[model samples]
Every structure is written in C-alpha cells, then in structure tokens.
Target: MKIISPCRVHMGLIDMNGSVGRIDGGIGATLDYPNCEIVGKESNEIEIEFSSSISNKTAEEDLKALYNRMYTSANNILNKIGQTGISLKLKEVIPAHTGLGSGTQVSLSTGKLTSSIYGYNLDAYSIAQLTGRGGTSGIGVSGFEYGGFIVDGGHTFGRNAEKIDYKPSSASKNVKTAPLLFRHNFDWDVVLTIPKIPVEEQVADKKEVDIFKKFCPVPEIDVNRFCRLVLMKMMPAIIENNMKSFGECINEIQGLGFKGAEVQLQKSTLKNLLIHLQNISYSGLSSFGPTIYSLGDKKEIIEYSNEFFDREGLEGDIIISKGNNTGYKLI
Candidate 1:
C-alpha cells in the first residue's frame, strides 16, 4: 500500500481567545506540490527508509525525532490491531519546520499505510488522534481528511477543556481534534517562497510556547474582526472565486491579534519580504514562517517573484502549487 499526502500552508491563527466560546480558530489549505509519499507492505518487522524530493534532500538528524514519533505512532496503532509487521518507505517529504504541517502529514501517512497493510479500516481523524496531532488547529488534520480551503472551529473554553496550554501541535498531546466549520474547493494557484534562514529564527517548541504565553488571550475585538473577514469576506470570496476580495482579506489578516504578533516576531528580512510580496499579490506568512506564500495568478506571481528575488538579491525555493480539493490518496 502507498499513501500520498498533501502539504498545507497555514494562513494564520484566527482566534486565540476562548472568549468567543472557542480557543483556536484557524484557516489554511492543502497544496498540490511538495507532498509526502509513503509506500509500504507487510514484513516480518517494522523497517523504514526515508528521503525527500526537495533539492534531493535526505532526512537529516533533525528529522530523527520526528521519524521516531511517526514510528511510535504507527506501532501503537499496529498494536491495537494486533498487527506489527511492515516495511515502510518515505519517497518524498514536505520540508519540516516550515509551517507546512510536515509532522501531521508524515504521521498520518504512516498510520494509514500501517493500518492498510494490516487490513484495518481507519479514518484520518482517528489516525491524527492516534498519532497525537490536531491539538490546537484542525487545519492540518482537515487538510489530510478532505483537502480544500478549511476553517476549523477550535476547542471550547473553560477549566474542563482538553487544551490547557497554548502551544504548537508537536508539544500538545491528548486533545480532541477541532471541528471543521467550513470547507470549500479552492482553485487558486499558490506561489510558495521558502527563504533559507538559520534554525534559531524558526519558531517552534519553547519559543513558540513563549510567544503564546506572552501574546495569547488575544483581544476579542480583533478576533471578531478576523471572524468577520473569514466568514463574511474570505469564505464568500472563495465561493465566488473573487481573488480580489480573497486577496484583500489575506492582506488584512496580519493586522489581527495572533497573526499580528507572529509578524512582529519575524526577522526584519522576512517581514520586509512579506510586505514586498503582498504588494503585488495576496501573500501571508505560513505558520512561524520563513515560508511566505502568495495566492493569485500563477504566471504573474512567478514572474514578479523572479524579478523581485533578483532585484533584492534573495535566494529561496519558489514553488507554484494548486489547492487540493480531494484529500490524501492511496495508490
């Protein structure tokens, strides 16, 4: 069995304050490029091989922890089903720690392949829970389940809520997957620019937790406006295929609370690049990003980006990918 999973670009965190009755509201979509592909079949024991198509990259030591996490998740699922033998090969991987939901995609892909090789019927959400994902934002999980433009209704507030801390999904464990409030087939071509930057600048783990601790409990007013932009503007624009309105909402999102703070935390170069790109096309930072994505005319955006990169003497990977309407597939 082989599973191919879509990569996602997290537009931004919509709401962090549970004041509106939910803790996290997020928006993102799955991309057709830079996907993770896993091929596996029954074996005497679990054996795994991993590689990537991005620049002919191999899984580095940095990915070891993630690899182990996926293995453990798959093992747990296999144990539940009384099956334990498989040989897994990761043919391609979305670049990790770039806010493209690499971990979730890999883990879910592992779980699905393992389950299928063992003759077990499993859904992606269950695969997510078993793999310890979808804690705060369901964007990644939703992207895995049914690819498209997605908005997740976050966890409910109060003491008994499963989410006690504001942290990234990697640090979050044992939380219910957020509900999918909206999904629409998005047909825009997204241009993704991933700048090469030092590892220290990429927000994750402790730094991510600190950012949340200091900046979270985002003001309700900002949250409300964000909701309005997503609900009243973005969703409608997506349905109507109005790129202008959709692009406008994408530009305005950074001014909102959590997204605003995230932008504030970005390095000066990245911050400038975001502004520069948004001027010509609809652009936003993808999750703790060094990856800035723009959605609009593919040809125009790519041409503009090529000119801008040369003009600014900047170097990065630029990929043009379409939004995925159907989720992960087994081939």
Candidate 2:
C-alpha cells in the first residue's frame, strides 16, 4: 500500500489569550506540493528506506530525524493494532522545520501506512492520537483528513479545560485534535519561499516551547481583532472567491494576536523579507517560519522572491502551489 500526504501552510494560531475559555484555534490550507509519500508492505521486523533523491535536498540531521519519527510512529501503530512489523520506503518528504507542518504529515503517513498493512484502517484523528500529534493546532491533522482552506474551533481552556496552558503541538501531547469549524476549496495561487537557515536558528522542540512561554497569553484585544478578521473577512472572501479581500485579511493577520508574536520573533533578514513581500503583495509567515507565503500574483511574487534572495545571497527554494481540495490519496 502507498500513501501520499500533502503539506500545509499554517496561516496562524487564533485566541492565544484564552480569556474566552478556548485556546489554540488555527487557520491553514493544504498544499499540493512538497508532500510525503510512503509505501509499505508486511514484514517480520520494521525497516525504512529513503530515496537517494531525498538526500540532495534534505539535510543529514533532518533525514535522521525523519527516520526516527517514521520508525517510532510505525512501532507505535503496530503495537496498537497488535501487529508485528512492516517495511516502508519514503519516496518523497516535506522539508522538516520549515513551517510546512512536515512532522505531522510524516507521522500520520507512517502510522496510516502501518495500520493499512495490518488491515486496520484508521482515520487521521485516530492516528494522530496514537502518534501524539494535533496537540496544539488541528490544522495539520485536519489538513491530512480534509484539505483546502480550514478553520479549527480549538480546544476548551481555563481550569480543567482541554488545554490549560498555551503550547505548541510538540509540547501538548495527548490533546485531541480540535474540531473543524469551516472548510472551503481555496482556489488562490500560493507562492512559498523557504530560506535555508541553520538548524539551531530554526525554531523546533525546546526552542518552540521557550518561544511560546515568552510571548503567549497575548493581549485579549489582539485576539478579538484576529477573530473578527477571520470570521468577517477571511471566511467570506474564501466563500465568495474575493481574492482582494482574502489577500488583505492575510496581510492583516501578520500583526495580530499570537501570529504577530510569531512574526516579531523572526530573524532580521527573514523578517525584512516578509516586509518586502508584503509591500509588493499580500503575504504572511507560515507558523514559526523560514517559509513565507504570498497569495495572488504568482509570477510577480516568484520573480521578486528570486530577486530578494539574490540581493541577500540567501539559499532556498521557491515553489508555486495551490490548495489541495482532496486530502491524502491511498493507492
């Protein structure tokens, strides 16, 4: 069996303040490129192989981490289903820690393939629970199950709530994936620019945890404004296919609530690049990004991003992708 899972761009986290008794709501869309593809077959013991092509683009440390994640997820699923093992081959993978939600896609793909090999079919949410994903944002898990523009309702907050503290997905294990509030097929063009930065410089694991601690519980006012934008502007634009309004909302989101904090935390160069893109077109940082995305004017944005990279002497990849209306495919 083979499973291909699409990558996602997490627009932002909503309601970090949690004053309204819910927190960690998120908005994001699934991308058609930079996906995770894995094939699996029954085996007496677990085995994993990576395509040689993957080495040219993915860093050595990232490959190791991917291997470990696949192995651990496969093992966990196998134990859950009372199965022994499976041989898996990774044909393609999303780049790790680039704010593309690679970790969740990889884990869910691994667990799903392992479960299928044993004739145990499970949904993304179930696999997410088994694999300890969907803790902080439901966007990744929801993207895996239902593609396109998505808004998750988030978890309950306050004392004895589903989540009491502000945390990223990695640190919030055992939390159920949030409920899906809305989903629409997004037809706008998406341009992704991933800046190649050192692993230490990128936020992940402990660094992500620390960042959350430093800037969380953002002001309630920003949270309220962010929610209004999403409800009144963003959602309506998607439904009506109003590119201008959608782009405007995307631009505004960068400076509101937890997302604003995330954008403020970017390194000077990346932060400046985000500003540069925003000036030319609508753009926002995807999660704790080195991957910044812009909506509309694909040609102009790609050309400008190349120019910016050249001017800065930076190394990275620029991709043109569209929303995937369908989630993962099984073949």
Best-fitting candidate, scored by lDDT: 2
Q: Which candidate has the top score in TM-score?
A: 2
Return the lDDT, model 1, position 283.
92
- Backbone clashes, each candidate: 0, 0
What range of 10 consecutive residues in model 2 has the weakest lDDT sum? Answer: 52-61
User: Model 1, range 47-105, lDDT digits (tens) per residue?
Assistant: 87765553356446556765696678778788878886678888888888788888889
Clashing pairs in 2: none
Instruction: Give the total clashing residue pairs for model 2.
Output: 0
Lowest summed lDDT across 10 adjacent residues in model 1 is found at 51-60
- Candidate 2 stretches with Cα past 4 Å from truth are none
For candidate 1, give the lDDT of residue 295: 78
Error (Å) of candidate 1 at residue 230 is 1.0
Query: Per-residue lDDT tens digits of candidate 2, residues 8-29?
Result: 9999999888878999999999
lDDT at 268 for candidate 1? 82
Which residue segments of model 1 deviate by more than 4 Å? 52-56, 311-313
